[model samples]
Target: MRALLTTGTPPTWTVTEIAPPAVAPDQVLVEVTTAGLNRADLLMREGAYVPSSADWNVGPDRVGFEMAGRVRAVGDRVTGIAPGQYVMAQTGGACAELVAVDHRLLLPVPDPQDLVAAAGLPSALLTEYDALTGAARFRPGDRVLITGGAGGVGHIGVQLARALGARTVIATTRSQDKAGLLRELGATRVIDTASEDIATALGPDAFDVCLDHLGGPVLAGLLGAAAPRARIVQIGRLAGTHAHLDLETLAARRIQLIGTTFRGRDTDELHALNARVREALPGLLRTHDVRPVVDSVLDLSEAERAGQLLDRPGLTGKVILRIVA
Candidate 1:
């Protein structure tokens, strides 16, 4: 079997042959069709990102976080999935031709499989799902704000915010070129932070719920723009790790600043979270109003090209790695 590896001090992606993963009792063996690249993979390459316990392959292996494929086999204890079923999941070592993922992590791919598109959905879906529904405690008719609206997760966040019934869905992006796409994805307002000020563009007390991935100065702006008692869920620190915020506004508004990450979460916690997504999948998928925005599709050997896209400020949506059959 061919698997991707990350070797050297500052890791680099490599494709090599490795023993196929043995399916665990509660797992399913999937023949990967396509995989998605998240910005976190960039951190992993630089020895910055740590693997979640749920990730199957750690160390230097080409560690892809999510994929969409067809089920080749199922473990003894696995139920509700069968061979030939198309599925997608957020899992470790997804850069490989095959991966044995816990059945709980697998979500059925819509029929007439558009594996390329499905490839990009899981990571964004899971991250934003938990961030909005769990950390931010989003409710229907709440005015929602998603920073980095053109991003892999943010675009999905935009659609989810609107699909779930937000009164207003405002998305912020540095790429003005993506403003129209963000609006198409359901953002009521798209603020280009490259030229516009987030706080000034949105005004005071504008957002009832904020799902922020860019910390640093972007986060500081969110503090000023947030409504009283608003929940600001911090999901990533892409902009920077540090921020000088206004304690006065924070206190005055009685805002709840929440932080979330998937690193080091135990199997039980992951199972529960996956279940949360499954429970809401019906409503979220039934409308068919939400979908991942795919920017490009590359082969597994094109890992470097995929990784480099993360550095481009104009990059919009997910980069998928298609493993040609």
Candidate 2:
């Protein structure tokens, strides 16, 4: 089997022959068809985000976060799934020809859809869903603001918020070109954070929910733009994690500031999120609405290129790795 090996260095990815992963009694063996690259993948390569397990390979680690594939074998205890079943899963070490995944994290691929596009959905969509519904508790007619609005999670977040009946969806992008694209994707208003001030564009106490993908000054500004009793869900820190917050302002307006990350979810929690996404998948995919935003697809051998591309500025969506059989 061939896999992308990250040697704990930038501008380098080695495709090496590695043994296939053995399926544990509680895991299923998947023949990966495509794998999705995420911002976390880049951080992990730079020795920033380490996996929970020490034994897990770090440098020269097999890298990949989300994948769309077919079940080649199922564990003894795994039920309701079998060989030849097409599925998408969230797992580490997915940049390989094979992956041993917990059955709970596997979701049936939607019908009449491209598997390549499906590859980009698991991590971004699940994170957005969790941030909006699970953490933020957004309701219909709510005015929601999403920072980093044109990035992978932000674009999807915009669509999901709209689909869930958010009355006014406001998205912020540092790139000027993406503002129009964000509006086309269901955002009622798009603010270019590079020049325009979010606080001024949206008057004080304007938004019911604020989804912050970019932290630092941008997040601070968002806090000032929140409506009374609003929810501020911080899902990413692309611009730097450290940010100043006015506790008095937050308390005075009854605002909730939540900082969240999905990398540490246990199998049970991952399964629960998967189930909720599964229920919502049919409607979202059937309408060809809220599709995964894929910026580019590279061959598996080009994993390094994908990583570099993700680091580039002005990226509007996900970068997927097309794994050849």
Model 2: lDDT to the true structure: 0.83
lDDT of 2 at 124: 81
Q: How many backbone clashes does candidate 2 have?
A: 1
Tens-digit lDDT track of model 1 for 1-325: 8877888766688888888888889989999999998888888778788776674444545678999999999999988898999998889888889999999888877443689988899889989988888888899999999998889988999988888899999999887789899989888898989899999887898999999989999999888898999999999888989999999999999999999988888888888888888777767877755788889899988888888886777788999998856
lDDT of 1 at 290: 78
List the candidates' TM-scores in order: 0.97, 0.94
Q: Which regions in candidate 1 have their CA more than 4 angstroms from the true location?
A: 55-60
lDDT against the true structure, per candidate, is 0.86, 0.83
Model 2, 40-139: lDDT tens digits are 7887777788765312322337687788988899999988898998888777777788888888777777642577877888878888998999999988
Output the number of the TM-score-best candidate.
1
- How does residue 317 of candidate 2 score in lDDT? 90
